[model samples]
Target: MDSVTVEGRAAAELLARKTSLAQTATDALYADMPELTTRYGAVGRERCLEDIRYTIDHLIPAIDLTQPSMFTAYVGWLDDLLRARNVSTREVIRSLELIEQAVRNELAPDEANVVASFLRAGLDSLGAVRREG
Candidate 1:
């Protein structure tokens, strides 16, 4: 009923539709993470898709402006997940960037920004980790 609720719903729907492009995003990701593409194969592909799904299934629902820490935690988990697979934080950042590019290419400006927020958060977390390490 309120604007925030409406915006969240619209952003949620946009993220869901945009996830259908996960495979394309994965291909783009391989440009920077070629080793991962070859090494991971099907598992790598699934992880790429899961990145998109996590934004859709989890972050989008919890995109609350009041509680920003949840978004931060989600992105942290993504970084952890990639590291657990022996992938570098740089690769994870690039993967998130590719997803942002895919969303920008296919959707409206506002919708792209909505989805980009989560992607950017992931990127930021990766940067933080890079700084720490």
Candidate 2:
């Protein structure tokens, strides 16, 4: 087997901390938009947590392979899923931005950059979704 690349190691580290990172991102969302409670109710909070966790789960492979397209593709599917449920695109965008911040803060600088590139791609995809809306 090939030795793990730096990106691979970083991806593994991210996977190891997935739960913590997801919770942190979700907490940030709640802090930034306290009205989420009234707007989305209790299930909304759980959904946010699940979304962050799912995002991180999908992100790990993109980071490991250094493929932004993989992450962006997932973002496209996520955009559709959220839209189907009558969720605001702004919330999706905001949640992604928060996930990026949470990931960046958790990893070392170099590792963070690797992850950030994929995140930027996902964010760009989200931007296009907003524009078309």
For this target, which candidate reaches the highest lDDT against the unseen true structure?
A: 2
Evaluate residue 80 in candidate 2 and report its C-alpha lDDT on the 0 to 100 scale. 88
Ten-residue segment with the worst summed lDDT in candidate 1? Answer: 1-10
Question: Candidate 1: which stretches are off by over 4 Å?
Answer: 1-6, 64-67
Among the numbered candidates, top TM-score falls to 2
Tens digits of per-residue lDDT, candidate 1, 1-133, equal 1245544654555555755667667778776667776788887678777776665455555553424456667777877877887877776677668777887887667767766876677677767877898
- The 0-to-1 C-alpha lDDT of every candidate, in the order given, reads 0.67, 0.85
Clash totals for all candidate models: 0, 0
C-alpha displacement of 41 in model 2, angstroms?
Answer: 1.5
lDDT of 2 by residue, 1-133 (tens): 1126768877887888999999999999999989888988999999989998999988998877778888899988987898898877788788888887897898888778877777888989888877887
Model 2, runs deviating above 4 Å:
1-4
